[model samples]
Target chain A: DAGVTQSPTHLIKTRGQQVTLRCSPKSGHDTVSWYQQALGQGPQFIFQYYEEEERQRGNFPDRFSGHQFPNYSSELNVNALLLGDSALYLCASSLGKIVGGELFFGEGSRLTVL
Target chain B: AQKVTQAQTEISVVEKEDVTLDCVYETRDTTYYLFWYKQPPSGELVFLIRRNSFDEQNEISGRYSWNFQKSTSSFNFTITASQVVDSAVYFCALSMKTSYDKVIFGPGTSLSVIP
Candidate 1:
């Protein structure tokens, strides 16, 4: 009965470098969503994947992309990282298509872009 | 456009005191959902409760209670007999059925319970 899990829990990268954060959704969950939470701010929606396809996206720029595997695991990739990109990247999962269900979140991967 | 707002940036209360966190939301869809989450120093968001647009009944769970008002477009959370363990950042979120299940979060209200 493991909940959402993400890794690497912490990482550091410099400008013009890229970083990949991974997440395993809760057992029996099919959808995965990514969020970015800057210090002193709430989690901001990044994008959501369902059926291995991006179902929806937020206001984030193209530097941020993601993938959802057949196993319902997800990866968030950020390229050309900037200092502003340094934040807590979170992965959340829900059972059904609608968000009316509870969204379980992972501990989050903290990305520190220098 | 959809948005969630927690006007209270921070609140501090002593143990055993009661405190309420305010949340105001905006959405164009007729039917939507609202949620509350708590984030401790550990940084993981713990889900608290969810309320759909149609159901306005205030929910009570142990010492926690939520008030959902459609006319006001506000969903408020109240913690009774609070303890030191209750110290955390609380967030309010909104999800519209037509918006592809994307959850929009508020700025969050940081609650500090002093012993």
Candidate 2:
């Protein structure tokens, strides 16, 4: 069975530009979450999508948004990117909104905002 | 509010040595979950272990072990006979039972096992 997968392994963008990263969750999984990891730091929760709707969000600003399709695939969009936006964007998937279950993660897309 | 803190920012030890990473968390919920994940240079977070709030039993997996102490609000990880391959950024995370989708991660501890 395929695990969580993310596209655009690496990309570069300038400030004020918008970028979209994609993710396909593991088979038999319906929940998708996005995280941002800056250099030398741990992954910070961005938001989570369940049943094609956003279920929970972190402390991120409105510029960071996401969407989930019927197939459980996800997309994270960052608008008006700042230089500090440069980081590794990770996608994780789980079976549901259940607690204590393992979260399968993708390799992550490295975003460089100049 | 929930938070995870890895006290050690970085640690280095000889290949044959043993190292421990300390994690302390703060959570308001009575029922929650704790987790450990390893991230190598490749940037993917590999799930290591997960423990629920009620189960405080210490777990041992091969050369790795975890000690969960509710009294201290700390979950620590130990690697025995560490090897170079064990070098990575280790993160301790917490998720509340009420909001499992939002997993809060610690700043992470960078481990380097030198040969």
Candidate 3:
């Protein structure tokens, strides 16, 4: 049983550039959620997707968006990225209708915006 | 607005010394969930435990234990006989059982266990 997997373990981009980070949820899981963890801080909720539909979102701006495919994999897209956007992007997966299930997290994709 | 607060910013203790991490939460919903996660230097959030609003039973798993108090809206975690490898940043999170699926995380407490 494979755990959650994320792509581009490390990446660098310039401000105002658009970036896309991908994630594959754990097996037997149907929900994928995205979180952002800045240095020295805990992970913050971004949004969640279930059944290929966005179920909920956090306090992030319109520049941050995500998509979930039928296979339960997810993609986090950030537009007009700011320097503050440079952080670790973590993807978590759970196996239930509610978000209270045990969340299995990926190693996270570290984005460094210049 | 839901919020989780970890009062201790950082802690250092010698190996074999016991340590406790405090977590206080704020939520209007009676039905909610509390969680603790450990983030080691390797940079991954590892789930520790989860406690629902109704369950006040303190849990003990190996050298780890959690105390959930709905009356005070607090859930504390304790590690017994800590080891050097136990050093990590601990986070507390809360999520309501309602339509809101977002889990609010705290500022995390960094624990350093020295040998």
Candidate 4:
């Protein structure tokens, strides 16, 4: 089974523009989490969604928001993107809540904001 | 506040040599969880191992091992007979028992295995 799939492997956007990245979680997984990784740095947790509601969130601002559909597919939408948003956006899926189960990551969508 | 720290920015070792990645954590919660993840060149984050606050016993899985010490709030990972494929950026993270909490990650340690 494909562990996790993300669309638009790479994206280029100008400042103030918006971008949407997609992710399809592993089959049978009900929870999905999003992260941002800067060059040579570890990923920073953005937020997590379960059952269409955001169960937990990180320190990220509202510019970074996400949604999990009824089918479990997820989307990360960033509005008024800034240069700082140029990084790898990762989507992860797990069997249960991240607190108890292991999270599997995807290849990540590389975003470069000009 | 909760934090995970991997002090070593980069480490290099020859093939078949042993290496250890250090992870130090800080949290006020009585019960928490720690995890190690590997991100290779492919950019996919892979879960390496995990240790809960209640369990201090070190674990041995094949050629990899982890040492969890509660007294010092440290969880270290060691690789034996390392191979080229072992090269990757290692990250340490902590998860609190808070109702709405997310895992926090360290800067990461880059491991390079040369043949």
Candidate 5:
């Protein structure tokens, strides 16, 4: 089965602009989560979408939002991007809403905000 | 609030040597899960292992082993007879058993196995 897939492996954006990163979860998975990993750092939780609704969110600001489609695909949008927004955006998928299931991750989309 | 701490920022060892990466976590939830993910130079977060709160029994797979000590709130990983391919940024993460709970990750430990 194909694993989680993310679009636009790398992209460049300027400050105050908006960008959307897409993700297709692993086959047979329903829940999708987004994470941000800065240089030399670990992945930080952004939010999670389940059943086409946002189920959980991290400490990120309102500028960071996401949507989940019926097909279990996801999109992460960043508005008014700041220089610090530059990072690797990772998309993970799990079988259910519970936390114990193994999470399959995508290679991630690298975003550079100039 | 849930948090994870990986104390070692970076560690280097000769190819044949072994290395242990430490991870400490803090969480209020009585039932939770702990995880270890390896991020290689290719930049993919590969899931290594997962452990639940009640099941503290240590786990071993191939050359890798994990020690989970609830008494110390630590879940440490050790690589035996490490190789150059083991070089990666290892992250320790925690997630609550509650539905929709987000996973919290540590700063990660970078391991380098030099030949």
Candidate 6:
């Protein structure tokens, strides 16, 4: 089975523009998480979705939002992007044990906000 | 709040040599989980190991090993017989038992292997 997969491996957007990145979780995985990794720093969780509903969220702003499809695919939408928004958006999938489960990450979509 | 810290910003070791990467975390919660991940140049994050607050037992997997000490709040990883392919940016992550789905990552330690 395929691991977590992301779309638009790389994206270039202008300031104030909006962008949407996609992710498909690994088979048998029900939870999808989004993270933003700035250069030189580790990934920071943006949010997590389970059962097609946002189960939890991180410390990100309202501009960052997401949705989980019935098929377990997820989409991360960022609006009113700023230069600081330039970072690699990583998508990770795991089981919804409510505790800890091994995660599977995608290659990530590199978002460059100019 | 939870935080994962990797003291080493970068490390270089000769092939076949052994190297250790340190991960120090800060959290008031008594029960939580610690994890280590390897992100090679290919940019895919590979799950290496995960240790809970209760399982302090040191774990060994092939050439990889982890030492988890709750008293010190540290989970250190060591690579034995390091190979060139082992070079990558390693990240230490933490998740609380109450909210295991929410994980926080460290700054990361870049490991380089020299032939």
Best by lDDT: 2
Which candidate leads the pack in DockQ?
6
RMSD of each: 0.9, 0.9, 1.0, 1.2, 1.1, 0.8
Residue-level lDDT tens digits of model 4 in A1-114 = 878999989989999999999999999998899999999888888999899999888889999999999999999999999999999999999865446567889999999999
The residue ranges of model 3 lying beyond 4 angstroms of the native Cα positions read: none
Q: List the residue pairs that clash in candidate 5.
A: none
lDDT of 1 by residue, B1-115 (tens): 6889899999999999999999999998988989999999998999999999999999999999999999999999999999999999999999888874689999999999999
Task: Give the local distance difference test score of model 1.
Answer: 0.94
DockQ for the candidate 6 complex? 0.88
Listed models, DockQ each: 0.78, 0.87, 0.75, 0.69, 0.74, 0.88
Model 2 misplaced stretches (Cα beyond 4 Å):
none
Model 1 interface DockQ: 0.78
RMSD of 3: 1.0
Q: Which CAPRI tier for candidate 6?
A: high
lDDT of 4 at B90: 91
TM-score of each: 0.98, 0.98, 0.97, 0.97, 0.97, 0.98
TM-score of 5: 0.97
Q: On a 0 to 100 scale, what is the lDDT of residue B100 in model 2? A: 83
Can you write out model 5's per-residue Cα lDDT over B68-98, one digit (the tens) per residue? Answer: 9999999999999999999999999998876
Question: Which parts of model 4 have CA positions greater than 4 angstroms off?
Answer: B99-101
Give the clash total for candidate 5: 0
* Candidate 2 residue-wise lDDT, A11-114, digit = tens: 99999999999999999999999999999888999999999999999999999999999999999999999999999999999988466688999999999988
lDDT (Cα, tens digit) per residue for candidate 3, span B21-54: 9999998998888999989877878999988888
| Deviation from native of the Cα of residue A47 in model 1, angstroms | 0.5
Whole-model Cα lDDT of every candidate shown, in order: 0.94, 0.95, 0.92, 0.90, 0.93, 0.93
**Fnat of each prediction, in sequence:** 0.74, 0.87, 0.77, 0.70, 0.77, 0.85
Candidate 2 displacement at residue B102 in angstroms = 0.4
Better of 1 and 5 by TM-score: 1
- Give the better candidate number (4 or 5) by lDDT: 5
